[model samples]
Target: MPAPERLLPYWTIAVPPLALTVHFLLHSSAGPAAAAVLVAALLGAVLSAVHHAEVVARRVGEPFGAVLLALAVTVIELGLIVSIMFGGQPEPTLLRDTIHATVVLVLHGVAGLCIVVGAIRHREQDFSTRGAQAYLTVLLPMVALTLVLPNFTTSLPGPYYTATQLAFVSASCLVLWLAFTFVQTVRHREYFLPLPATTADEAPSPAAVAPARPPGRQSLAALALLLLALAAVVLLAKDVSPYLQSLVTKAGAPAALVGVIVAAIVLMPEGMTAVRAAKKNQLQTSINLALGSGVASIGLTVPAVSLVAWWTHTPVALGVTPGGAVLLGLSFLMAILTYGNGRASLLSGVVHLILLATWLFLIVVP
Candidate 1:
């Protein structure tokens, strides 16, 4: 059994529920200052929950661990998006903007930071090229078909999809995503595994490596906590949305700024974990987390929101603006180059960060 102190982190599991109850009881009359404090507390609780999820991921091991982390974070992202969508008058463009922002954040911002930090520290970090190729192969087309093609299609007036197109496209995305999931978890799992170290010095330290087997009871507890935390986040997100929206509005920020903030909040835990893995020279794990989260955000989120839109008779737009399309294309090209050689350098990181900056700039300027 692990030491008792090692389990101290589990105490955080109670925070989300407590925070949610308190917010519900108090938020109706809470002023802006009080709301701000509540938002901070909620964000902190979410981060703590994310930490617990990371601990669980470590115990689960490899490809599965990455998948678990991706799913956990994606759930948070989807929950927030869904809650906001249903909370008030639906913003037709909100889903599109949020999805676009999420892809950029994960594929560019988070991934870039990880690569830069890893490259600067290790000088060069290597990961499985096959793994990246698999991700891009599915990701590029999905992004193009879902986010880009909608603008060009005559099947729908404006950049919006008709019911038929939405159904078809949503189903296609889900199918493709499911197929990719099977490959990652089953067919070619080895492709995602870390490459063998070339020398003893390159090998991970004993303490840094995962155990041969994780404790079952501990794993179960962690899983329970993860689910509870996610539920709390979703439940509380409805209350948090108004404060987030007001903050952006008061600053005279672009409407898309809301999407960016939501994406950043949802990606925080996964991004930190990925960056830490990169710093440890576990670039493969970092790559998996970054790309996997991006994939899940798009693949899972679009279909989900589509279903909701259909049920509610809400208008859903999936197309990127012309400027967004161009930026998205550039980001795809950058990702291809970044992962092309199975190695990353500071230059690669810089290019991605530049693209991320462009995306953010366009949100405000365009």
Candidate 2:
């Protein structure tokens, strides 16, 4: 199909919200399970939009376009999720755990799957194994400390978890996210560097790297837009969440619906990137972006939301439940093994699928 035709298919963005509307009208009330599905579909649409933008950027050979698209989606997705979170009865620690989950999914699962698939398909190791290893090493300890351990103990609020404790966790996650982003930024710089005066191929010089913007201007712009977007999402969520949460509380829906819905909303854009990359044979970059976004989502999104909760004096839950912790640990381990060697195999892909299935099962079973 032509590019024009491809663009038309992206209209699927309309599906998610429409589905939510239909759900609202028909049921006049929906449960968490339904809500979760709706949210996931919505997020998937968002992810698809980002992936499409990246495709256009790739065709045009414009990295800036990709960066802009990523920035836009990141802001939008975070805005929507945070808004919904605040709209509901406050789950302070929820933001932290969700962020942790997103990181785990990205670092170990999505990255591992991409590497494994790409390696197998290309019949060669053509990607960055070291990057994957470094990511997992840092990710595992951080998650174990911040998420898994906290779930089992209730000493979190006053003693083991104080104002300082929360700040440390939130800041640590953000720093980790920044560290990963730095890696990508550095790699992009390296790629754009001068090939040296001795190079034989005569070609026009690649465009000069843009001058750095002042930190103040960038920070102010980010803060303003983020505030604006978050406010908008919060308004929408306030209208939506009470009804949704009530439905769940009243036993009209399953309890596990919350996680599913939250996952869908955040993971939407990511799924789009993955399928598109697989089709394009650019699976490595796709994996990198998908997993990268996931990590960013967990690391960045949680802290930002948690800070909001803190300001509002809401409860924040950063740790996974005992069962959830176990599943997450196993998932992380499998992901590390799959992507550790920088090579992928069909079997590795199957392992990730299995892990996802396990996650779903755990969420659904009481």
- Best-matching candidate per lDDT: 1
Clash count, predicted structure 2:
13
For candidate 1, lDDT tens digit of each residue in 1-366?
Answer: 454337536457667667667577756755787677667756766786676677687787755765676677767887778877667645577788887888898788989999999998999988989999999998888888778888888966767889989888888878887788889978998888778777788898666654444467766777776777777787677777777777778889877787788788888877898999999888988888788877887777888888888999988877888888888888888888889899999999988998899888877777
Pairs of colliding residues, candidate 1: none
Residues 205-303 of candidate 2 have per-residue lDDT tens digits of 443123222244333433343343333333334345565566656864444455455554566556556655544345555556666566556566657
**Which window of ten consecutive residues has the lowest lDDT sum in model 2?**
191-200
Task: Give the number of the best model, judged by TM-score.
Answer: 1
TM-scores for all candidates: the values are: 0.92, 0.67
List the global CA lDDT of all models: 0.79, 0.54
Query: Least accurate stretch of 10 residues (summed lDDT) in model 1?
Result: 1-10
List candidate 2 segments past 4 Å from native.
1-71, 107-126, 149-160, 187-239, 243-256
